[model samples]
Target: METAQRQQQATPGAFTAFARFVLCGGGVGLASSFAVAALASWIPWALANAVITVASTLLATELHARFTFGAGGRATWRQHAQSAGSAAIAYAVTCMAMFVLQQLVAAPGAVLEQVVYLSASALTGVARFAVLRLVVFARTRSQATAHAPRPVPATVARAPRPVPAPVARATAPATPAALCPAA
Candidate 1:
């Protein structure tokens, strides 16, 4: 609790996390590129790219949530969902950026692809971490902290009243038809 308060007090600009993400993203990108290049002959570049992305993504997410962002194991399934959703949005932006930087701007072909990818990775990492840390995970904690269902006042709770056992009503016996004509 005290540590969190201190952190909030000492909060650096938001850009710091992004800068860290960019640097960390460099590391992740190197690993991912190797993973892709190694598997290139066997798999399509895009498919291998996706595989590497998912793996590096999980690694970066864990690092950012725990060490970078001072989050405490906050990247759970819901956190990943929000982060991944945000990353999807970021990917669109990344694609657009890559298109502009690579095709439109006539950036170098060979290494530029990786550089552009790293740029996009940095963007995606920063955006997704913020969403995961503050929006999704923080909201979960905030939900627990705020608006918690208050215990009902003991006075307001009515003691359970014993329900009476259902009585089985006696049914009247039906008289048989005077005589069975068929018999």
Candidate 2:
């Protein structure tokens, strides 16, 4: 009982949540990477990347809300907004890295560009997980414990009450004689 209560009071552990985030994020990343690469093949790099980034961010936010964080009920506009913000940060990192790499390598091929983007995205995953866990899905201690129910005892043992000692009665000779006469 004590251990269970302490566990409830403690903040949620990161290992399980991180694992879920990785699984969900990996799927989203795979889909988005393909989209980015395909879109870049046809459209201008900047426009294709931006459009795909927004779409993928929305999709990933919903996925993470449902599975990664276990906050399906709490998913709201605010969460979407945070997801967008985090995605923007990640996108900026990716774009900047791509630009620098292209300048340094001189007309890098499509495969190389894709690799750079994926690498940047991988680095950004750490930040994204942190933001989602600490900011977006943050729960107060009270809020965390609010939904939990207290355990009811199956049986209760009550202490026995002590018995009082008996007292001797005082003699009453006159009263006894009168009572005897009446009888």
Candidate 3:
């Protein structure tokens, strides 16, 4: 019964993490859309999208690490690589969505472009979460076993810190400067 209880307790909850993830993803999508739109006047939409996609993916990964996964310290480059993989897939999907929207919706406005990117992000969110939770941040079986809480003795005394000794200071003798003759 206690083992079963421990098993139940060890399982990570979803609702809070999912909510944060969605919010972070939405913010990334909005920022990416604005970036793309801002650059569109100076550059082609494809180039703009590529640049913003890379930037947003990095931003989103960091945000998700802190807000969504509660694994800020634990998140590593490998986990980031995993997140990047998801971002790559998401970027491809967003580009396709944009292409389709351009064909179907004439003269897409700022609002329309944002909406399209957000829709794509919403579609990709599930896959991103799955990879982050199951692959990137997942604990090994040994780690899980090791992490199980053990009973500690209530009366254990804490260790005391050692005191430091004062040291004698040594001073260097000053050297006199030679006077220069008038030039």
Candidate number achieving the greatest TM-score relative to the actual structure: 2
Model 2, which residues run further than 4 Å from truth? 1-12, 140-142, 149-183
Q: lDDT: which candidate is best?
A: 2
- Across 1-183, the per-residue lDDT of candidate 2 in tens digits comes to 554355354544689778988888878887888888898879977778899999888888887776677663445898899889999999899889988997899778878887888889989998999999889877533445665667677887878888877888876777666668864
Q: Tens digit of lDDT per residue, candidate 1, span 1-183?
A: 454454453333457656665566567767876676577559865566667667776777666665555454546776666666675676566557655775566535657766776677666766675775568556534544344355566767778999999999977556555344446
The positional error of residue 111 in candidate 3, measured at the CA in angstroms, is 2.3
* C-alpha lDDT (0 to 100) for residue 79 of candidate 2: 86
Winner by lDDT between candidate 3 and candidate 2: 2
Give the Cα lDDT of each candidate.
0.62, 0.79, 0.74
The TM-score ranking, best first, is: 2, 3, 1
Q: Per-residue lDDT tens digits of candidate 3, residues 1-38?
A: 46544543544467876787778887777777788889
Worst 10 residues of 3 by lDDT: 173-182
lDDT score for residue 54 of model 1: 71
Clashing pairs in 3: none
Over all chains combined, what TM-score does candidate 1 have? 0.54
Model 3 has a clash total of 0
Task: Give stretches of model 1 more than 4 Å off.
Answer: 1-15, 90-109, 123-126, 140-183
Candidates in order, TM-scores: namely 0.54, 0.71, 0.66
Candidate 3 lDDT at 17 equals 69
Clash count per candidate: 0, 0, 0
